[model samples]
Target: MDRPHSTSAPRVRRSRAEQKRETRDALTVAALVAFTRDGYHGASLEGIANEAGFSKGAVYSNFGGKAELFLAVMDYNLGALRGADWDPLAMPEASGSGAPEPSAGHDEDPARMVRGFGLAMLEFIATAARDDTLIHSLRARVQVLIDAYGRVAAAGRPDDEELPVDEVAQLMAALEQGATMLALSGAASIDSALLRTGLRRLVTPAAAANEPSPVRDAHASPLPDVERVRRLIRDTIDS
Candidate 1:
């Protein structure tokens, strides 16, 4: 005889909870890739499940549906970009934290930037807009982000009726959404510089905080008119 045959090591059985957790994690990761690649409407539970090596039933068991799944994806990737670039407190330079700077290499591939996490985000926003229930589900999470944004807005600004931090935060939030939509669409060329400038200006505001305050002195300057003409001219050029 050559040698005695030895059995392989015993397989360690995982608990049901462990299996479920693992299953959910795997499914979520797969869903992330699917949503990123196909977007909200384009991604399917079956496809995500297949990608994760689970059956479609696995997704149903773990999540309410695709909307919930995407929300989980957002939660999973909160920093989303994973760079130290995010500071919900992306405050004014006065605080020392300073406003976020544009990524070092965003110009590399505009399409990739949009179609990556940005497209998935836009897709979910569109889906959420049509459904009150979905928007409601999103509001809590949005509130948390807005709260941090509000803090950034509130730092040096007053919370009074003049330059309500609430409105500033909300407006900044809207600008962010609108810009992401336009940037992702590729219908018109939009760039990070425009987004950066919008944030900077909005954070700083047209009216100096000390002079006439933010909301009050908006009309005290001719710059707004100049900007309007410039924007119109740019639009005409693009058209």
Candidate 2:
């Protein structure tokens, strides 16, 4: 029997631009790993380049230096944190809709995602604190997150009943940073589910019954209760 001619098309070589992008992505990933393992001040461009199996020239060509690479890592990790796929049931409109949001992590474990990003963020913040230029840059990136939080809060409720956008953003930011500090201090008893759900509740203006919940027993983990955090935030503001 004559074997059918291979129908698969030949792979086209990547253009220079595409190859450069791949190299940049590889270098970024390697840099992130290296930064996490060795503190930012301790990590080197040479080490990162080697980790990516590329020459030190590739590091300079892609990121220019270690500071740039570290910022890139922060951008990637923070972007992921901000871009998490929140449950629709957590939405303000969920009160009228019967569709329930995923009880726990949605598609992936929120805890792991938050913890990893939080740790990296702490490291980046420490480095940025010492440098005036980097502090300004860090502030700019943080402003973006603050703006994003404001937008989400606006979407959740009517303008008349809506909380101050800045306050909402500040509250959410405090929760995240506090949780991150706790985890890093060996008190990781709290997980991301509580944080995610609590933020939804605080902004959505929905009754407790309509709030989305964890799919499994929340008590399974020793994490801080989302409701508690929500209450504290509310009380602090009201008081």
Candidate 3:
């Protein structure tokens, strides 16, 4: 007996919105890789689109242009940085959740992640220095992050901890940026112990709550030990 042949309809295509979201995600990923490798001025949208297997038209349709795309990539990297648990060694016991995972690559390393963020921040600073439009955009984004942090802090705080959430957020952001820049410059180095001590002072609630700070008193001490620590870091870097 001959079996009758039958055909089912082909699988349904993805919804237009799903397809668009996929495209945007792919472009974002490609842009991050490209920008990290080539830097802000060097990575082109056309190249990013090509790498993502999308057309340049697709990029234009999804984003306003290169600057907007660059900012989106910055946002993506920053989001990853925020998602990762920061190094427990850098904070007091109460402040630290856990040590951040070992980095699989430059994009994954916390220091390098902070460095990448610093570079993007530099771009924003440079643009804001000269352009009104970018200044406005930067201010709006800053406020949004601050407000978002305020909400998270409010939700997470215990009833008794009167945390100055916004100030804490600002200090953390500033230190990460400054530390990355300093590390990259190679002009000076901080020993791990000294680094941890320094960070703990700024990061823990005692200082973060806007109280009379130990950091203000600790600076009065001599730094012969700190200098030795700096030499060790330089030697490690040179090696």
> What overall lDDT goes with each candidate model?
0.62, 0.64, 0.57
TM-score, structure 3 vs. true: 0.61
Task: Give the number of the best model, judged by TM-score.
Answer: 2
Candidate 1: where is the Cα deviation over 4 Å? Answer: 1-18, 79-85, 88-117, 156-161, 187-190, 206-239
* Model 1 residue 32 distance off true place after TM-score fit, in angstroms: 1.5
Write down the TM-score for model 1.
0.61
Winner of 1 and 3 under lDDT: 1
Candidate 2, residues 1-239, lDDT tens digits: the string is: 99889889998999999999999989888876776666676678888888999999998887757777877876765564455543322422222266444455532333443344456667778878999988998888888777767767767755555568788777866766676577567866445455667676667656533866644444432233233323333446559
| Residue lDDT tens for model 3, 32-133 | 777766767777889999999989999999999877786677576445433334342332222135735323452134334334545656665686668777
User: Model 1: how far is 29 from its true place, Å?
Assistant: 1.9
Native-referenced Cα lDDT, model 1: 0.62
Displacement of residue 220 (Cα, Å) in model 1 is 34
Which candidate leads in lDDT?
A: 2
lDDT of 2 at 172: 69
How many clashes show up in model 3?
Answer: 0
TM-score-wise, the better of 1 and 2 is 2
**Candidate achieving higher TM-score, 2 or 3:** 2
Model 2 Cα displacement at 1 (Å)? 23
